[model samples]
Target: MAKGSRADHSARLAAFSAGIRATRGGKSLDINATKLLVAITQADDADRLADELVAKGFRLTRLKTHGGFLRRENAAALIATTEDRLPAALAIIRQTCRARTVTWVPPFPDGIGGIGPAPMEIEVGGAVVFTIPIEGVELLGGDVAESLARTRAAGGAQ
Candidate 1:
C-alpha cells in the first residue's frame, strides 16, 4: 500500500470534524433535602444535568464518576436539598425517567419524594434514576445491623 502523505491525513481529519458537527445538537425545580445524589448511566449527560440542576438553584456537591465495589462505573451527581422540595424533585425524576437510558438513586428516606429535593426540568432524554440511601459513612459489621435490631426490639416485640 502506498503511504499517503499530509494530504491524506488532512482529508481524514476534515471528514471526522464534519461527522461530529452533523450529530451534535442540544439544549429542575423544587426540592429542599439535605443531600441527594443522581446516578446516571451516561457520564456526558449526567454532567450536563448537574450543570442544569445547579443553575436552577440546587447546590451540587459531587459530580464525578465512581467505579468500585460492585459499581458499574456509572456517573453520579450529588445535590444538596431541603426537606419539602424532595418529593417534588422525585416526581420530576420519575417523569424524566420515561425517556433516558439510565438508572437513578432516590432520596435517602426512600420512597417517592423521600427527602431529596425535586429537579427543575426533566431532560428530554433522561431516565428514572434510582436512589440509594447513603448515610454518608461506611459502617462496620454489627454497627448498623445491631442498632436496627435494638430499635426493632424496643418496638415491643411486634
Candidate 2:
C-alpha cells in the first residue's frame, strides 16, 4: 500500500510540474516570435480573409466593424502567429484584400442654399494590418480567441 501511494504522489507531482511549465509559456515560447495581427477589412473581404487564414493554419477571431469614412460594414480580424509565419500571413492578406475607388458625398452640417455637397471619388476596400508583440496570453473559460496568447505561450496552436 505504501509503495502504491508513493507512486501516485510522484505521478501527481509530475503533472503539477508540467502544468507549471505550460503556464510559464512553455519552454519553446518566445516573446518576440509571438504577435497579434489586427486586420481591418471591408465587408466583402473579411469573410474570405478569415477563411483563408484558417485554411493556412492560423487561428483568428473576427469582429463586425464599421468604417468611419464610408460608414459601411467591415470586419476586424484578430490573428495570432509566430514571427516566422508573419510574412506569409501578410502576403495572403495583400493578395486577398484589394482597394477600389468609391464615390461618396460629404454630409454638410452647415450647408448653403444653392450648394449642398459635392460627390467625390474616394478609395476603399482594403485592409489595414497592425502587428503587436505579445507578452503573455491566456484563454478565459475557453478559446473564444482570447486564448491566442495563452495557447501560443503553451507551444500550442491558437
Best by lDDT: 2
Question: TM-scores for all candidates?
Answer: 0.34, 0.66
- Candidate 1 per-residue lDDT, tens place, 1-158, comes to 13364433333223212101111111001111343556453444565565556555555554456554324444655643545556655554444334443344433564656457543433334443545443333224433333333433444121
Q: What TM-score quantifies how close candidate 1 is to the native fold?
A: 0.34
Stretches off by above 4 angstroms in model 1 are 1-35, 66-73, 91-158
Candidate 2 error regions (>4 Å)? 1-33, 110-112, 142-158
Considering only N, C-alpha and C atoms within 3 Å, which residue pairs clash in candidate 2? 137-150
Model 1 residue 157 CA deviation in Å? 47
**Candidate 1 residue 27 C-alpha distance from true site, Å:** 44
Model 1 residue 72 CA deviation in Å: 7.6
For each candidate in the order shown, give its overall lDDT on alpha carbons: 0.42, 0.68
- Model 2 agreement with the true structure over 1-158: per-residue lDDT tens digits: 26446444333223222211123323222232377899999989987888888798676889999767778899999887777889989998999999999888988776556676889999898788999986664433532232334444454422
